[model samples]
Target: MTAVKFLSDEYLDELGDLVTPDLPEVPHVNVRLQFHATDTPEGEVDYHLVAERGVVVRAGRGLLADSDLAIRASYRDLLAFESGELHAATAFVTGQFAVTGDRAKVLDLMVVLQSGNYQRFIADLWARTTW
Candidate 1:
């Protein structure tokens, strides 16, 4: 079987689509992800994504400093979770993911994920995983 890989950019794009419809009409929110490698010797990588008016306006270093939420996860773990091979709750329970910043925002994001549209999110994730 081919191993799955989750690029930070692809992950941000899929997450933006997943939450856009469910998010309130806020001005904008910046979210940064600091990905740490639990199994690799390499340090960590930072990914930034900006959402505005239910659209992703920016991603990568173009994102602003202030963020509504920040999350930490290993690349492998994130890929697994995105592919639906691992559940978010289970990942959290197993210490594979950690979230910080606005807890409410995180919860809202989760609500969106749990909603019926999650199927679309899963499809997008599958495409990215195989790409």
Candidate 2:
């Protein structure tokens, strides 16, 4: 998975494994990711995550029919966050990360983000990614 392109099909496909196990503590959270990167073929891509009973059963491209939250950000910023170079709070406060939709969902994501599991997952993903 080295030299991976940002938000490419392969990247998005692999996201499910990394993200699913990290949400074991929260089961009712669903979110949509709107990724925008300058070099992407379409300049943007979308993904949705649906976790139930602490497991992610569905995660793929496009928005869910009804989503709990929408987390949007540039490709670089997202990479930075996942790489631990950009703090989530700093990214949000600096406008690098924009979150919308249900507050409860956001809270659940926040919990995951605060946990070491998320950090480990991010690190693993970053390791697999080339840039």
In order, the Cα lDDT scores of the candidates are: 0.55, 0.64
Q: TM-score of every model?
A: 0.56, 0.73
Write one digit per residue (lDDT tens) for candidate 1, span 57-126.
4454233467777667876786677677888778766767887677666544554345444567567557
Per-residue C-alpha lDDT of model 2 across residues 1-131, encoded as one tens digit per residue: 46555577777777766555544465554444333344355477787666554445566666666776777887778778767889878986787877777756665666556666556765777677765
What's the distance in Å from true for residue 105, model 2? 2.5
In model 1, state the lDDT of residue 79.
64
